[model samples]
Target: MRETPDTPSPRSRRAFLRDAAAAGLVTAVPGLAVSACSGAERTEAAAASPHPVTPAASSPAAGLTSNGYGRTAADYARTGLTPGTVQQWEDGFRTAAANDDPDVFEWWYSDFTGDDGTVVSFTLSTRLDDGFVPEPGEDRRRPRSAVIVTDPDGTSHGGTQEYDWSEFSAARDRCDVRLGPFTFTGDLKTYRMRGHSGDVGVDLTLTGLVPPFRPGTGVIYFGDTDDHFGWLCVVPSGTVTGSVTVNGKERSFTGHGYHDRNWGNRPFPYSVEHWRWGRGSVGPYSVIGADLHLREQYGSATVPVFLVDDTKAGKRLVGAYDTRTVTATESAPVPYDDPAYPRDYYSKVHWTYHDGADRADFTFTDTGQRIVSRHYLTSPTDAQQKALDRLGIDEIWYTRYATDNDLTLALATTHAAGSGTGTLEAAQFGLADAPPRTGSSAS
Candidate 1:
């Protein structure tokens, strides 16, 4: 099954591209700063004429530590660094993360690289299940679940499944959820994912190396509207012990694991056109970071969110603001062998991070990156579905870069600097407008 969005509400342009993004991995030609698709950006507004949905004023419970969080919706409500921004998780998958927010979206993501050049990643999010609003007759959910595994040989394959609302289940109080053949069960300390993909499958367990990283109320508000992004690095740092199989041949991988969740309602392209996200284990220290933009309402920073963690100095929540900064200097444009994907915004990025007097710089060279697998998502509303259906070709190219980098991490006085392997994703979501395809036509 293809991964698609739960809402059918079309934004602008063709609804299919937005809908497609909701489901899974898509590759198309696009660029940053330029419109990635023929889509329109919507100005979000709250229903003052509103529903009785909980307000964003709630905060995590006092003294409730991040590691103590569980699958319960309330556990999440009490997450983040700020109080009142959190909300309770309810039965069904959506409530556990998105609750009653419209344009609702969320995901459970994990990834790890084996010592033998093998790379594996997984995402189980709002696309995997449905229902942020409580309704017995609401079955607007489309393609519900997703699983992708890139094999050691660079071949990528996985599965996306949609279930009847009656078939999907989300534990009312914990992180126990099942949408089709994908199952995720976890407490604060550890989590396990078991996925099925035809003849291939992945069963992995991840144990946290640090507590969950909650920034602010985990909500980043965009402009005056309710269009916002919620991010929580649940497993900011962790160790992996699992087995992956391809056509019945299986091998266990012992390496570092990273998991996080992100949710939003508005079409992503409308927010910011492009972004670079990455997480990797460099020896004993785990690293996770991202640099992205979300227009003006996101404070004074040129880059709304620029974060990096060595995983040893706890987590840099909202407290890390002002002091922490990242400057990404694009070295060069990445070339795509796939002519259909003409955009090459992917670059060799050099990032310099600063926290007060401490400084750490790392360059993420675009090397050893390739096409492993792909997935899809669609618009939710019937009207949007029809809109998407008319778009013909799907969304743009979303590429992943696994780089070899030398990072220097300084905390207070001590510094850890070394060369290690890391993974970064360069995705042109066409988050705004549609740019002309730049490469050669496919033969």
Candidate 2:
């Protein structure tokens, strides 16, 4: 994930640090830019590539036209976007929003699940709250780091820390990022991470087993030219070997790990309503899936992304964003702490993907162990709470859970079914006024 021949010139380090001090937020870097090519241009680019990626399967003859999002294959065909292609510089930091836009944010996140049932996860971010848009001159973008460690006994330990902007620096050419005492640096194939917050600490190395991946250009547009979100799975599934320290006690572990990067300039409450994202390995497959629901103004589209790799065959079975090839369903309402908000979130989700003669079905059920539950408004004033309520932002919650997974696959040459364990995340930002729940708990 470092600089390649395609990398643009990076911003001056001195200027970045100086402006960071004055503004207290990590704005866009000089070389960070988004490609807003026209449909014709994108088509031309696709035609030029030696490997022209396309949807895994043709549209179903008589079923859902779009993926979870209301986008049909024709829509993607018009935009010339698919669920493949990984630009060399896509894994680096993307802070390309206007300097004065408090909505701009970026983060690198990783999690490891040990063979002995322990889980360790951490994140280094420019901002901790996705729903809080700061006022002009407000200093709220200090570099933030958070860690969570879950022991085999189901106990979780970790905390969040914020540091001055002076302590933050990241390379535009690759994935070299430092915040305070923590560091995360790596190439797309391998990574080294070391950090600590509160009583938990981790020093780990991750070796990639699958190549880096992104859906199409890895950028999801929101009906506007400049409004979009970017995502890249630098390490879809990897081998993690490292040491974790808790309460001054250290233990060594070998396990599986996953890492992904996210960056956007649009406020969460105004853009995304909720999303279900998870990743794991089952049988001979390593899989990642997500269901993203946009807000009403953006046509309330449901965008689905799913990827499946056949480790045994050493090839990809499915990498798709079309409804005919990928779809998802969820049930079992998981009510929020605030009673006034609707139970729009779910505790269970099922994803299905079909490509040619290969197919995969994955179901993730929450084990009822909540490792982290964060409320954006930790301490809100009366007036501020009122304003948020008027905007229908009942409560913004971010929750991570330990999950059990059941998977079945039917490929051209193999058929298998198995069960495993993994991690799942639920993010609710603007679901206060969402429609009434319809699905029963029985799926």
Candidate 3:
């Protein structure tokens, strides 16, 4: 397992900010700072994956405060929280070159073992850029596709599927996915994903890459914030592949197990194409979940889309939420790095929507989260370049929840009555646990 990122006692950010500013790398805005280069030369491709591991530079400890989180705008690009505006520009760039908008840009794969050692796994990703940028050459759109699998370690594996239309089709929820002869079901209750790599099959680890910084480029953000959602939890499966017997049947799968949770609190209004998700326990009973939201510019509006895994039955549109009860909380610097930073750490949250006949009372807890700080500089004209300035996003998240439910959640950053007062927004809603699995495996 990789070493966990540091969750300092709120003071470390100041120190990091001071060092960045002292190096003559200050952002014009007081609310955020630019990440300075350490004079280390890096490949252009690798530059996008900044700050691989700065958490180790801090002091080690037992447990961190439960409510600890961040609101850093610079960390956006480094983490994978694609703001709609940034994606809009990137889509424009792709349009000018590829001539075809990609159906899926990002994905997630997760494997978990339930308490009984029943290996369970899932994957999810986006399809067709209905709301994404189109290629300069191609005037038509294609369907976005995604897939997921479970019991990867069982005699018969299980999973789900998804597809999206760019033109005029409702987003298809849980569709069935075929793995060789056996078929897996899809649902909104699970996360799903798909991607290409000349390589055969890839491991769906529950971690994402953080981009490195470039002066004027922009930061990267990851996790489920503002407008996306993907969270999967694992309880007790062990590592190792191959078939295993469960309920008198043998099975086969590809990965190991770790107790965990996966969920998001992203805002809507931003256009997103694809995503992948997985969850693991950062602490006992407490889970740590992560998601990747791929954004591409559409037209006038930024559409935020998501992909989920339905591990139980033939999937359909899962219950989702578009809530209005969001609330924000502001905080101050604790005292670690830079003192000039004056922005309050904002955590905008709303209740999860529950689907029921009588009362619509629903909820999901964001058990824990950590910040991935990033800094960059960029011009506002180029989508990739423009992504740098407005690209800075605060991705505060939770990995574990109280129950297993299907829901569409969101998080967002809103301007406070004016043009540029940055306010962080985060929210989640529980949709439904979904009906139980039915019928036998499909072929």
Highest lDDT: give the candidate number.
2
Clashes of each: 49, 10, 91
Per-residue CA lDDT of model 2 for 44-144, tens digit only, reads 11112211121111222212222132233332332234433344345555673232355667889888889898888878887755424322123555668
Stretches of candidate 2 above 4 Å error? 1-85, 96-100, 130-137, 312-314, 334-345, 378-391, 432-443
**Best-to-worst ranking by TM-score:** 2, 1, 3
Model number with the top TM-score = 2
What are the per-residue Cα lDDT tens digits for candidate 3 across 1-443? 01115532323433554555567554433222234323112112211222221111221111111111221333332223222111111111111121132321322234444334444444333222222221211222333232222232433333343333322121112223332222223221222322322212323322211111111222222222112222222222223344433334444444434322222222221333222122222111111222223343422221121112122221211212112221111122122122322222212121222233211211222222321122221122244233323433322122221222222322121111111111111221110111122322212
**What RMSD value applies to candidate 3?**
22.7
User: What's the lDDT for residue 187 in model 3?
Assistant: 28
List the RMSD of every prediction in angstroms: 13.4, 10.8, 22.7
Models 1 onward score TM values of 0.66, 0.75, 0.26
* TM accuracy, model 1: 0.66
What C-alpha lDDT values do all the predictions have? 0.51, 0.65, 0.25
Q: After superposition, how far is residue 238 of candidate 1 from its true place, in Å?
A: 1.2
Summing lDDT over every window of 10 consecutive residues in candidate 3, give the lowest-scoring window: 414-423
Q: Please identify model 3 stretches exceeding 4 Å from their true place.
A: 1-100, 103-113, 117-119, 124-383, 390-443
lDDT value for model 3: 0.25
lDDT string for model 1 (1-443, tens) is 01137632222212343344455432322221221211111111111121112213122222212211122232233221222222223111433444433345566677776767566777665543322221111244433666666767767766666666565666644467776677887765578989776766888898876655544445544443345455666667777888888788888878777777666554454455455666655555555556664433334233423445545554442222222355665555545566665454545666676767777676676575654423223334554444334433244335676677767877574567788777777654432323324533222
